[model samples]
Target: MLKIQEIRELIKLIDKSSINEFKYENDGSKIVLKKNAGTAVSYQTEEVPVQPVVNQAPPAIESAPAAEPVKASPEVQQESKAAEEDSSLHKVVSPMVGTFYAASSPDDGPFVKPGDQVSKDSIVCIIEAMKLFNEIESEVNGEIVKVLVENGQLVEYGQPLFLVKAE
Candidate 1:
């Protein structure tokens, strides 16, 4: 079982992170933390078999009125066009859920950036999971065309980290 202090620390970490949900399992204990639509956060601790903390269902609320659809701005359109152009590019995706680091450390420069050339084995970024820093590599020889995630953002498994135009 996880001690209260450790659980509190985990909650605070999750609250400060961009990740919406985090699941941790140790021994026979499991902890699930999830953020709601607003600032509210819900968490639960259970054994091997996951169970709800409260058996009662929440009261239903009426749906809000539908709003008019807004048109996309010039920047949004340009980004959408760029995304379409990147379809042929090779995407470097995160192998695991973690915090993305553009550089090896705060004092160092990023391994690669947009328009930077990279070999198949070139390190592109770092992903920190469970206190372990994993150096992520570009598996294809290419020029980095775009970076998908921001530094210090939480990245999910298989989420695209960089887009490369293969040579």
Candidate 2:
């Protein structure tokens, strides 16, 4: 059986590589990994007997024909420009998958809000996992531009929680 850390590393490796699909079988275990444009990574595992199969060359993957680019309308162009501007801001991302908390307790005020200035060590929020509350700190010195998450939201690892304009 593969360990959790090993599976994580495999996913990272597949994400960075050109291979879109990978399959492996050993003993009574089988694993497959696949990726799509919008989907980061998807995998499946099953406990089945390994079957003996002849080694065959992989099928050639043909590239799709490219189509001419369509020009965007004026309104669409304006919205695209605005999105580009927002991309310049730094993001405070979740370090682990957990339930996000905006304050220490239900009655307490939030640790930080939009327009607040924070240093690298400032504790911006808390994340609860397995009944443990972890204080999450900002890794950058910046002024908070926006809060991306609401209180008590389920946050995924690496998901952006706040946007900031760095000093």
For candidate 2, the lDDT comes to 0.77
lDDT of each model, Cα atoms only? 0.78, 0.77
**Model 2 TM:** 0.50
Clashes of each: 0, 0
Q: Give the alpha carbon lDDT tens digit for every residue of 31-141 in model 1.
A: 677655543334444534565444334557998774432345677557745874667988899999888899988999999988999999889999999899999999999
Off by over 4 Å in 2: 1-85
Candidate 1: worst-modelled 10 consecutive residues by lDDT: 38-47
**Among all candidates shown, the one with the greatest TM-score:** 1
Q: For candidate 2, list the clashing residue pairs, or say none.
A: none
For model 2, residues 19-52, the per-residue Cα lDDT tens digits are 8777766555666666555224333445444343
